[model samples]
Target: MATGLLTSEQAEQIVTTCRTAIGDSLRSVTYFTRDDYEQVYLRNDLERDADLSTFIGHEWRGFKTAQTAYEGSELGDYNYTIRVFDNGFLIRVTNESEGVFATTDGLTVKDFEEVATALNSFLGDREVR
Candidate 1:
């Protein structure tokens, strides 16, 4: 049965679609079964210079915003995180000098909006059992 919320199946679909869109750039997909989240990572090592790896790519993490705790509080929202590296990947999360900014870089703004629209459309199309 579908929970109609952010589930593992949905996460798989989202990550799979992302991999498809990213094509050869996709490096790996990490799923946290216990946490119910996914990480879609990409790399352009072959095409891009090794030194430019940071700016060239990043990772995507999606979760049920309602179930996950952010900043110590649960806001009951659906969202994702993009872990971006500007210089290198060895930088620590707490290092302020790394110049790494975490934002939504998985999908472009237009694509994200389109996905939202599709999800909304699915709500209407869903048939009750």
Candidate 2:
């Protein structure tokens, strides 16, 4: 698969995986590379015109940093991040070259693992642990 941007089929797979894990609470899906980003899906109830450029940039940097933060630590490989908010959650699954971050209304502890694991699987084994 290409690293620059997600193909429509890939984006659809992401949406389906996310919805399957998070159910109706899935809020938004954003795919980002080192240089650019795209919002593949946004729930109908959310704001359509919100400024996300700054947020996307932050997420990209944060994800990249997380990938290397614990090199050789006993905690093992980096997997994902879940940031809680008053209204929702931001779950980021990343590799060195590209990433997919999904926002959802809320999730059970198990839902978090399921979504992260599913997305990480979607990113695949070639991306490094």
Candidate 3:
């Protein structure tokens, strides 16, 4: 349970919990898995103009393992992408959209932080894989 080392099932549960914590702010959350990524949460109806998405992927490059959360959406009219990697994370805001922003802006920084914090806290308590 190292930082960003969530299994596919654990990632799904975390995403689901985070989505529930956000409550009615999101219209819906779709969960699925992909080839490279273990799980993904597609959050719709974030605000009046954007939807948020979170995806988890893990891989071992030689002896080092990398687990990360690839999150993207709009905090307001401006779009943002947050990449949460093991041990550290980064957030970037942008004015240009890759056409992923929806039509609302209800998702707030506080809300996002709450979810991220919860995930980080969960990871902090477990042994590193």
Candidate 4:
């Protein structure tokens, strides 16, 4: 039962797909549309009361600007963003309708590439539905 745009099964699939790419290093998965968001999964080691509004706002505003920011540039096109922190990484994947952000422990460059590819494929397919 989804409290938002994504179904429970779809949420599970997102987690499964990401975990397959990044393993237990993946910490949490949150789904967000333009107006709302939901934490579909969180690791047991983590706290429940995170303030996700900041990330949600970034995804809404930043991604929109990002898509247009690179238009006609040699950089080609906009893909995802990986924000690195001291102890973790924040991976953001978005399409026009919605997006998902995943927090993770340490990961290799290949792991980042694979997870980005996996998430983009998943979210891209969802936009058609």
By lDDT, the best candidate is 4
What global local distance difference test value does model 1 have?
A: 0.34
Regarding TM-score, does 1 or 3 come out ahead? 3
Q: Compose the digit string of candidate 2's lDDT tens values, residues 1-129.
A: 234476678889889989999999999988777677778889988887756677778888897677778878999988889999999999998877778888988789899899899888888843422
How do the residues 22-71 of candidate 3 rate in per-residue lDDT, one tens digit apiece? 66553333222222222234345233232222322211121021112222
User: How close is every model to the real structure, measured as TM-score?
Assistant: 0.30, 0.87, 0.35, 0.91
Over 1-129, each residue of candidate 4 has an lDDT whose tens digit, in order, gives 135677777888899988999899989898888878888879989987767877799777988998899878999988888889897998898888888889999998888889889888888778433
lDDT on C-alpha atoms for all candidate structures = 0.34, 0.82, 0.36, 0.85
> How many clashes does each candidate structure show, in the order listed?
1, 0, 11, 0
Poorest 10 consecutive residues by lDDT, candidate 2: 1-10
Better of 1 and 2 by TM-score: 2
Between candidates 2 and 3, the lDDT winner? 2
Write down the worst ten-residue block by lDDT for model 1. 91-100
RMSD of 2: 3.6
Candidate 4: clashing pairs of residues: none
